[model samples]
Target: MILCFALGIANMFHLHWIILFSVVCLICAFIILFIEIPLLLRVCPTSPAFDGFIRRFETNYMRAAIYFAMSAIQWISIAAKRTSLIAAAVMLLIASLFYALAGVRGQGFVGSKTLGGQGVAQMIV
Candidate 1:
């Protein structure tokens, strides 16, 4: 998120590039939302191996939600057509705050010790 914000700030003079970047990010986010998530949900229920794969990666649904929120905010900024860089920066910062809150609430990727320990054991075996 910091990287995206920094890129937006650095390219403030090139609004076209920022807009393009935001579009690309939104595309990737949609791909994950539409394709990857459904596949994961379908496979995770009946496939123990796939469940292990997901656990091994420490996938955080909370973080994914934050990512989706950030992508939506970027599109909103583009649509508003006014100080998009500033708007993106503020929105991304708010997203980061939600990310931190997720960590505090034990919803972060690899944040919970019990889950982290289980992941380590699964990986080792």
Candidate 2:
């Protein structure tokens, strides 16, 4: 949302498509994340730890992608370098923060060794 808003503020007419695409992606991501609940009750939903980590990773990745894309677009469309620099900074910050956090978490959740011969992991998308 922040990324989208920032792009709009940078150049409202130029970034309208980017903003729309970002919103649509966000809505789809939310729906997929929410839909995981029912799968939890099914025979072989992913372990909570793995699922949680995946969700968080995906969410943060999405945010970072939006920031990066918007930053590039704004930098191309607008003359102001400062706005682009700020967006780039925010992108780096978010990407680093979430990935670092995910790594710390995945260590505990993903376990040291992989479990072989487990059921096939089903992905919605």
lDDT of 1 at 45: 44
Whole-model Cα lDDT of every candidate shown, in order: 0.49, 0.41
The alpha-carbon deviation from the true structure for residue 12 of candidate 1, after best TM-score superposition, in angstroms, is: 15
What's model 1's TM-score?
0.32
Q: Give the TM-score of candidate 2.
A: 0.28
Q: Which stretches of candidate 2 lie over 4 Å from their true place?
A: 12-80, 84-88, 107-125
The per-residue C-alpha lDDT of model 1 at residue 3 equals: 47
lDDT per residue as tens, model 2, 3-119:
534443443343345444334334433333333233432334567775554355334345445444444443443343233434534554565466456555653323211221123
* TM per candidate: 0.32, 0.28
Question: What's the lDDT for residue 67 in model 2?
Answer: 40
Supply every candidate's count of residue pairs whose N, Cα or C atoms clash at under 3 angstroms: 0, 0
Candidate 1 all-Cα RMSD: 10.9
